[model samples]
Target: MNNKSLKRWTFLDTINAALLIVVVLFMLDFQNNATVSWILLAVFAFWIVTVILRNIFITRVMKDPNHPMHPQPGEKNNAKD
Candidate 1:
């Protein structure tokens, strides 16, 4: 795709990845208490949903063969910008 759309999607992927990492870290931390675990679990579930949606969006975008533009061979595949 074009650089504009590519950059927007890349930013979204980075955001989603960050959220996923944060949730995982919170879940794994030994200092987390019971209530904290529950709250983090709730937010983790929501973030998981968003992560799945983000994955679907990226998958759909990749499957779209009629992409108006594509990156050059030596450029980054996921982050064109």
Candidate 2:
């Protein structure tokens, strides 16, 4: 991957990690509460779905020829142009 893509992934991963920590803290603070457990479960599910969507977006940006990540002239054509 190029430097730009690497940076993007790193930034996203940091954000995701921070969010996970917040969720874990909430879980700890509200231990044994049935309502809190259900809320946490829904939040966790939403987080998973968002991560999957982010991966799909990153893959498309890297692979789509029309994207700025596309190779320059005379360079290797990894994309299915």
Candidate 3:
């Protein structure tokens, strides 16, 4: 993939990691609280949705000829032509 695509992926990964950390911390801190458990569940659900959406986006972009990450004729794989 191109640098731009790599950077985008890195950013998305960082956000996901941050969310996971938050969820873990919250679980540790409020393991006995019912309301906090529900809130954490919502956050976890949102994280899962984001991961699924990111995968879908990557698949679509890789398949699109016009996308910068897609390889073109006479160009190296993952190189923009």
Question: Top TM-score: which candidate number?
Answer: 3
Q: Which stretches of candidate 2 lie over 4 Å from their true place?
A: 1-32, 69-81
User: Each prediction's TM-score against the native?
Assistant: 0.43, 0.49, 0.52
lDDT against the true structure, per candidate, is 0.61, 0.63, 0.63
Residue 61 miss distance in model 2 (angstroms): 0.9
Q: Across residues 1-81, which tens digit of lDDT does each residue of candidate 3 receive?
A: 443432234556677788778777756445478787778778778877876686677677767979776655655443121
Per residue, candidate 2 scores C-alpha lDDT tens digits across 1-81 of 352322234556678778778877765445568787678767777877876676677677766768776555666643331
Question: What is the total number of backbone clashes in candidate 2?
Answer: 0
Model 1 scores a C-alpha lDDT of 0.61
RMSD of each: 6.0, 6.4, 5.4
Better of 2 and 3 by lDDT: 3
Write the residue-wise lDDT of candidate 1 on 1-73 in tens digits.
3463344345566776787687677565537477777776777688668666866665666566565444455
Q: In candidate 1, which residue ranges exceed 4 Å CA deviation?
A: 1-35, 67-75, 79-81
lDDT of candidate model 3 versus the reference = 0.63
Full ranking by TM-score:
3, 2, 1
Clashing pairs in 1: none
The residue pairs that clash in candidate 2, if any, are: none
